[model samples]
Target: MTNASDAAGDEKTKTANEKAMAGSETDTTSPASPTVRTEHEDDLDDAFKYLHDHSNAESTSIDLAALRRKIDWRIVPIMFVCYVLQFVDKVVINYAAVMGINKDLALTKNNFTNVGSAFFIAYLIAEVPTGESTSSHGANKVLTHILQDISSRNFHLESGWALTCLSGESVAQRPQEQPTITLFSPHYYTKSEQAPRFAIWYSGLGFGQIIGGLISFAFQHVTNKHFKSWQAMFVFVGIATSLVGMATFFILPDSPMKAKWLSEPEKAALLKYVSINQTGIQNKNFKMRQALEVLADPQLWLLTICTICISVSSGVITTYSATLIQSFGFTPKRTALLNMPSGLVSIAAALIVGFGVRKSESRWAWLVLCCIPGMIGGGLMSFMPASNRAGLLAGIYLVNAITGTLTVIYQWTMANVSGHTKRSVAAALIAGSFSIGNIIGPQTFQARDAPRYYPANIAVMSTQAGGAVVAIVLFGYYVWANNQKDKRQAVEEGLSSSAGNEKILWENLTDKENPNFRYVY
Candidate 1:
């Protein structure tokens, strides 16, 4: 009896949604190309009966856990490794700081810091084209090139081609494969299941940090006369990063409907399952209105602001963790070993929150939960005396826990936002804002504020606290907006409260444009 009533209620809600969408100019009613009624279309629908059944679940017999595991093996590794390479590419320089990069490169006061900042500035400039072009062209063709610059240290090659390939093999020569986060998430998992998987994949950041530390440490023992220790570190990590990028370029599936590994039924079922995401399989048509909507979106700006705050903390740590340890008067060798544990802290926090989001109902609360530790770590660093080395080191470890928050914000944006162009633009803007903060973060470690780097530590803590307040404000805004929508629906359409609760999936509506689109709190 209960199942029957539930089914009836769901049907009623779905009917109400269809009525509401028809009255409004929404994407579901947008014209699709008239089907040529070919045998190919017939084969697709026949093999799996859900190609056109966008809202219904047709195959519950397939074990979700087993299938998700399969998807994990195929999809997650390249995303993780490429991201790891991206971090290691940036992080090797931090290791270089302790390894005599300053003396070798003839780096003077603030020269090292400037080199660090230069990469992000280049990253900031590159993101606009990376986002726009990758969305228009396929992720395979353009992303491989743009992401190479991300992993390359070429931004500091102000000295021309000589400095570019100084390693006998240029780190810049590595394949630039920027995995499209927006494209992949919608294709593989439902919004509810995405956070944990993204968290696990994002755990790659911690792994990369650990790998980078080991690489740097091992190179320190290098007896080879041909290459300097830091130079060897770059060459090794760069080559390994390139191999992974090439593998990803060839292996990663572009869409659920087109994945080579999946049988036709499996492909159709996967496509049917993710269809409620409302993001079309792939759209080449870039809309200016959606691009403009990105600029106009207040929530997107809030998301961007939150990411900037978190990324600032990341930037400070990435560029300066080794430097800070060295400033404590530890030898360069020991400093490398001490830095390895921060990655472990980050991994623990990332997995905790990733799985936490999977189990919990609220995402905003989780964001604030992650921020509290960052705030505490910042306070410890700000107020504690420099002599309290153990206390300060503990605080540094605590601060790394916030590194996982970047993963959270990325997942939130993916789960909540829809419309292909709008999501693409939003992803680009968030990435850009993240780079902008990183660009700002290292500059906080001015040469004048050397040794303790108190100013940078203070920035990490304060920005985290401010971000928490902004998250609550955004949460309130979502709740208030949801209420306003409900009242309007009642007044305008005489919709009952239950009917007003209906939401339109698979229509690709932006949160602002669709009354049925509810914000994730």
Candidate 2:
């Protein structure tokens, strides 16, 4: 009496149920036992397929600690170098401004500010398409490495004394993939471990700041008649970045499943271990429903607003810090030297928050803590007399504390969001929001408000405060959502909320759809 499609569906479901029962009955400690298949094989995450084909009971006995270490050593360094190069490439112009880029380009009025803003505008435009492509394809190492190579080449070409605004626009379009690198860790880490891992790579921002300063200082001494100091610095960094890109292409794996260094048993064990995240390893299916859900999701909006608010301060720090430092009457050489300490402050803040989140699991508290220093710094910058160069410099360094907050936010999105399609969209939206704030950030520094730039300083203080409040709201929302899920599960099952939770881990459900999935603030 049933139709062909219904008969086929029933057969598939029956087979899946049989496989599940068989898997459950097998010896848990036996290395040779076949992988367990879930009841909803077609709808479940791609990780389920990997487990069915490659994993065994041996995964239960593998030494997870040793495996984690091996994975870390292989991948983390490549991630760190990529981040350092990305930030350095983007911020080189900030140093160039001090090293006579403005005079060389004959820029006047708000032209420099426009150049800064142009990059983010391009970033914002590229974000959605980039996310779609990464989701449709995979966020594999090969795709990312190719983007890095292209970015390096773009920087190299731009260094050839192209028109300032045009060069900024061209270079801005390429670094969109850099944030996508953060997407790689969820495949390799659990929710508890991702914060520190993310911090390790994100700290490259600090290193980039330090290295950019040194590079600028070193190149400022260049006396070549044919090449300006900024141009030489760009060319040198571009070559170095291209080489790193080449290295990454060869060294990095697409995913834990594809890692050549790991034995098959090791790969299986690692996959089994990270499955607790409930956020699948990879799923190429681009569900339109999932993408549409991102538009209505309250979490996405709140996180977007928070990202924008915090990134405003980030924008100010990234593009204008050198110019601000130089405005205090320091020479270009001294300005470059002074900028080095800000990097140290950034590094310290990132390490503190990274470890703090790992130990305390209080991401909301750390986020607020970061904002406090930024607020203090902004107040000093806004109100302090121009004569107090030392106080202003201290304020500049303290503002770098907020950079750590972005790292926390990055890990938050990965830990909390699930359903590969939804996660991809959320990541892109959050990154695009960052670009929005950065776009707003440079424009705040109008030419009329030069030197002290009171309005720009006040904007930083306000945005930091706003970000803190939104983070608290987001924390509360997660708690409320978790409570609702617990209540619903208790009522439906007449038992504990966690009953039969493991079966749903690989079901490829979004945070909203998964009753067992708990959000971490």
Candidate 3:
């Protein structure tokens, strides 16, 4: 009886091995045309039948423990540090502008505004290409190269700025006439010089974000100190990012299936894990037509619109929160300290919402929740202007909290998108919209509204409310669409309802394909 059972088990194992080998061959030999719609459905059908009907529980290939072990540690922490530093470096310029950098440079009001707007302009132009490259290559490699290039690009610019500062300081002390060097002119200081300063800073902002989640993934054990700026933060970030890039060459896997860090048992498990959910590219070809199809999705348009509104609304405060607070009666140092809390609020909000979305498997809840504080903050600051100082401070903190939701927007897109090209393009477009909004937001803070900027506040309040409404509506659409999909799949597959909660749709994979993929309201 024992020998008979062993022989039967051996036969079953042999058959399973043969099937897996055949599947491998099929995947490798499949047509390169995404439009071909090759054997994916057939393979899925077989996988579904086996998992659904068979009692062969032991035939599964899933090992969560190994997956946890294979992930690289350097990616996530460095990414987070880089992002936080990027924001700090970007915003600190706003502080410096108000401090002495503007007066020292004698930057005309119009020129200063251009300087600010220039950051986003370069960001808008570079983002799409960078995002596309990041998508085609991996985020890690792209991030590393970008950091190196941008850092090298900025090294001389910063040195020039520093020397210019020294010259300015010397003139300030000696009370001499300004030199005929024409620092602002294209001949003396070209766009090649000044433009990079803007580009690098904004690019750094996007760069931080592009890889921020990976930071969360790798640095689950990190603390707040990891993000703070006192410890040569920018320099550290440049070095760390470079190092991570070097290390990732060995440690970072192209995909779960391609991870060399994993054993054969672990690789199989990882593939199974990824396969359980559909992401439009089931080893599908990456094509320009599919890219265009993604672009044609209306959901992408809605996202771009929402991003613009949100950027306009939230960005105004990011540029001037400290200045606004100083107008409220804080000293320069105190203003800096006050802005620190707002920064912390943003970081906390990002982490909390990131984890919450991943755990609850609900992007809408976090999106809606984060938007509320900002909306309320904007409203309170605008309408309740005569309120207590503490209340005003609370409002400002909440406004800062809005900073992290950009991550929610991107992650939500990533979760919904499976096609590599589509995700890459969509992320860049969304980022471009954000840059446009940022450029517009700060410009609205005219000199006439120095202290309070009541008109700007009102505009921000309106936009924040608009953003909140958009989030709620999008959430409802996603829920309804998810249900419709589950129903369709059930009826066609003729399979008993197995909780369709894990269903991945084509529209979801396309980044804009699904009318069902509501924006992260």
Candidate 4:
């Protein structure tokens, strides 16, 4: 009887405290509690529920000034240098190819071309796992792993294995060490070996492409000719990249949450900024099950398809940019000069998309805004006669502008998706589509259609339009679904619209089980 009296008195005290606390405007919900079990446990459940839900909420405004002071510019520059060198080393091949790589290697029409396409096949296979590697381990870990893989593959080539294509062409290849050359034939290697090596080459490409932006930001002062210098451009870049990556091994943060360089206040600010920004998936470990679940989603698959179409359009340049420019009667040097503008456009696009676009909210608009010009430009170049050199160059720049649009698409994928597994899988899916387009892009460049491949230009224009339409429709659907889910959740909790939204904000109120999560289109 004494114990029961004590419990009643304690309950009354708790009620009084709750009422007093409720008068103030701070969330006190439990974060760790599950919304299951018996209704009879109302008081206990409410307390636990409040604790679990309120932990993520706070009233602190972002201190932009203090946060800027905390940034380690030294570390950022080193990271930037590492990324730049990685890109320049990979793409120097493009400039080198135009200069005379095929002639030096004695590469035939089929042989020289096959090596380029082979990279994509390898990229598609390796990139999925590599994306996961970034999530599971960290950016530094994945970058290190790639470096190791590339070094190993280069060693394999150096040790005497001739690279070949399925067409039975012994493309320009490094010679093997064996006295008898019979083993050097296409019969010597397995398809499995070729696939992985090809994948690695393309994986290198993916790194270069993404890091290109980081490079541009780091050294925007350097002229194109300076960057294109024979010794400094390729050889210096390779050496510098290796050195900077070593430096970054100590400085670069693995994950935002794991950044020890930040003080407690800085860390809290960072988390708050990311949370309100709607930057998804800050956790370290990769979740394979969640990735599989996302794969099973039709919305994700459709996005992949859209990615493939857009990639194919962008990929035309990967295969035929120099050749097409040469066909226009520009000298080799002039063609190289023209290519620089595209990179500039890409850099501009990254800045605008990364900064100007506040949320993943209007991805479709950004995509179309960039894409429509690309198609119009490509169409003008392809359909218009080559006699108009200035027109053709203008069209080429337009096509190049698509690079920025493609980057935005990639960013959108990262923003919309949550959980490491889904992100890895989704990244791979998008990359694989990119590879397919690369393979297909070059094929569109028929020798007969050369000097002016009207059909290839038409194809690019049409597909880009298709991609835009799909993005628009999908984005609308995503917004509509979010609204319906919000309503349902509000009704379930017996809350008014504003109150429900506040509750949801405090509790992570979106249904993880319900299939209504909007895929950023």
lDDT of 1 by residue, 1-521 (tens): 11222122234324543453332222112223122123433322221222443323334355544566678788877677767777787788789889877776677788777777766775666566555566666665554553454435423332323342332133222222332654576677766567777787778788878888888888888656545677777777666666666676677755665577876546645554554444445655566787788887777888888888887888888888899888877988888888888889889888788777766637788889989989988888777888998878877788888766777788888776766678777777777777778778888898888787889989989888877887888788778877887787768764443322212333345666655555656
Give the candidate order by descending lDDT: 2, 1, 4, 3
Q: Number of the top candidate by TM-score?
A: 2
Candidate lDDT scores, in order, read 0.66, 0.77, 0.47, 0.48
- Residue lDDT tens for model 2, 67-137: 77788888888888888888887888789899887887787888888878887887788776766677565
lDDT of 4 by residue, 136-196 (tens): 5656544544433322222111100133231112111100100001111111111111111
Which of candidates 2 and 3 reaches a greater lDDT? 2
- How would the candidate models be sorted by TM-score, starting from the highest? 2, 1, 4, 3
- What range of 10 consecutive residues in model 4 has the weakest lDDT sum? 171-180
Error at 347, model 3, angstroms: 2.5
In candidate 3, which residue pairs get closer than 3 Å at backbone N, Cα or C atoms, i.e. clash?
76-214, 76-215, 471-521, 507-514
Q: State the lDDT of candidate 3 residue by residue for 159-242, as single tens digits.
A: 324523432222121100000001111111111121221222223343333233233223323234434221233344445545
- Predict model 1's lDDT versus the native: 0.66
| TM-score for each model | 0.83, 0.90, 0.66, 0.69
- Tell me the deviation in Å of residue 68 in model 3: 2.6
